[model samples]
Target: MGVLLVGGLMACAPAVSGPSQAALAAPRVALEAGHPERLRLVVMGDQGTGTETQWQVARAMAAVCAAQGCDLGAALGDNFYPAGPREVTSPLFRERFEVPYGPLGIPFIMVPGNHDESWLWGGDGASPRGAEVQVAYSRVNPQWVMPARQYQASVSGLLDLFVVDTAPLAAYLPSVRPQERPGGPWDAAQRAWLAQAVNQSAARWRLVLGHHPLYSNGKHGDAGAYDHLPFTFQRGGAVQALYAVACGQADLLLSGHDHALQLFAPQPDCPGTWTAVSGAAGEVGGERRGRRPAAFEVYGQPGFLWLEITPQTLTLWAYVVGEGGAVTGTEIARLSKGS
Candidate 1:
């Protein structure tokens, strides 16, 4: 099937699975989309199969999102672990998701992860294919939705985020390759669109959120995940584009596929300052047996990322939720506005 984006207005490409005797229902909102003024949003990611951890992570972030009175929440990727198992609209999503995040009652905008697609693509149509998965997700969980393979969200117009799917980071490969794939107008369209959005908006920050990592010291190897065969997260100058987004003086960018957390300041190599890898939503471990990176200030823990913003300053934190639903991991970063 073709990429079916339901919220036609937004870049929502949901994988569509045909006819389900039972499916999650999506609440039809007017065919309208706009960014409100001075809004607060919650961003989290990589809450894989860690039933306990994902739950704790959701509860904590939900509280913050609710308390902050934010209308949107973000998730990075690999949402469900061990390769999605094809049957996406299962209790796994509803029970694990609709049940917990529903209380927040806000629109949860998300991107696809290697896990989100799962075994569906590996000859598992009965399990639910691409856009169909999205359709199912929307059907089962109205409070949540995926804006196509790529989409855009303007944070009060002050910030415009281009969310892209890096799953194909390394183009489509039968062997679960390492790098990202060459995408459609998604990345290019996003960059060109960003140039226009930034010039048009009176807002101070322009950020990008996705499931992959550009600058990371975590489990994944270097900047490029070519693996000597194929795949390049650097496709279409992906990394350059990411940095360009910041070089253009965009405030910050956030992502969550690494299972750990990271923060970057204005360094010589990068002028505009960047921070990301905040997933830790629920899983305490990563794709490779919970190994902690030597360079990571905090690693191998269960936590979530939080962002508190205002006209004057922006504060970001990492909360490590521990045993008995306990949270111990916390890191804060304060950013200043560019003149």
Candidate 2:
């Protein structure tokens, strides 16, 4: 394990209801090269449970941002659970999303997760159009931004974040003959947009975000059932999307679906782009390791990622939250021009 442990925390933002004060005293990790000169982003995924655990992580995020400062906060899809809300004004909106994260006070950039798109898959799914509702929310809430299903957010001079919809990438969609379905055309459009975005981005750092992990080590690892379900470009499946478009261009691809936190370096087959799974913000799930060892893996722990990007270095800190809102283990990774 290349993980490092730290002791002592610089008091987090005012304590919340859950996690005791003692448990919230864990060390707060900071970058060694100092704070980011360009952008600071906090990324979390699969965190829409609206449980105390979710609130705990959100509290930690608020504290960390308050202490270190953050420009934006992003959700790796799955903003809701079971099924999406019935309408833009659905009570679930305020309960699951607004209540917990509203205190952060930063614009939240989001993409729809598989659960958010559950309606598309089956029964009574029409009530809440998770994807559509999120976009509509952006109109009223300044902090919530998911302007389009497939869109890009540029952090000015530093990077471009291409947020994509990956629910359709599941093998099930086309299995039902999508050409005749509503999702068929949209799926094709998404693929085309992804390929073009990766090629056209001229930013110093190009990061692509989707709800599904291109590669993962938890329940949905490379050896998972969807492993061979190829995307438009790759013969095998979703992971190939990164190689097809992000080969020598994109710097990082972030996703959350596995309910675990993982970091994978570029492998021989998929070179140049680094993939990370930050899905443990609210859920603490099991892991199936050794199938494909991640550069770093942390499960049975709910946490989030702090990404500090500068011109010279891109540093990521995987902060694990324990009992209260304290950050326990902080796994750090730094990437530069060349390996």
lDDT per model vs. reference: 0.54, 0.67
User: After superposition, which runs of candidate 2 have C-alpha atoms over 4 Å from their true positions?
Assistant: 1-36, 120-128, 171-177, 180-185, 227-239, 329-331
Find the candidate with the highest lDDT and give its number.
Answer: 2
> What are the TM-scores, per candidate, against the unseen true structure?
0.71, 0.79
* TM-score of candidate 2 versus the correct structure, residues matched by position: 0.79
Give residue 75's lDDT in candidate 1 (0 to 100): 75
TM-score of 1: 0.71
Task: Give the Å shift of residue 206 in candidate 2.
Answer: 0.7
Q: lDDT per residue, candidate 1, 1-339, as tens digits?
A: 223222112322343222232322211122123333344566778775658677777877766564555555677766676555345546667665667676776666666665665443531111224434653566445456653545555544345555555555432342232212234433454455445544555655666666766555566532354223343543323534544554545566666666677766654555665656776776555444322232234567767766655566676766776667765535467677754
In the range 125-163, model 2's lDDT, one tens digit per residue, is: 222256767767766665666766667766544677778
Query: What's the C-alpha lDDT at position 162 in model 1?
Result: 57
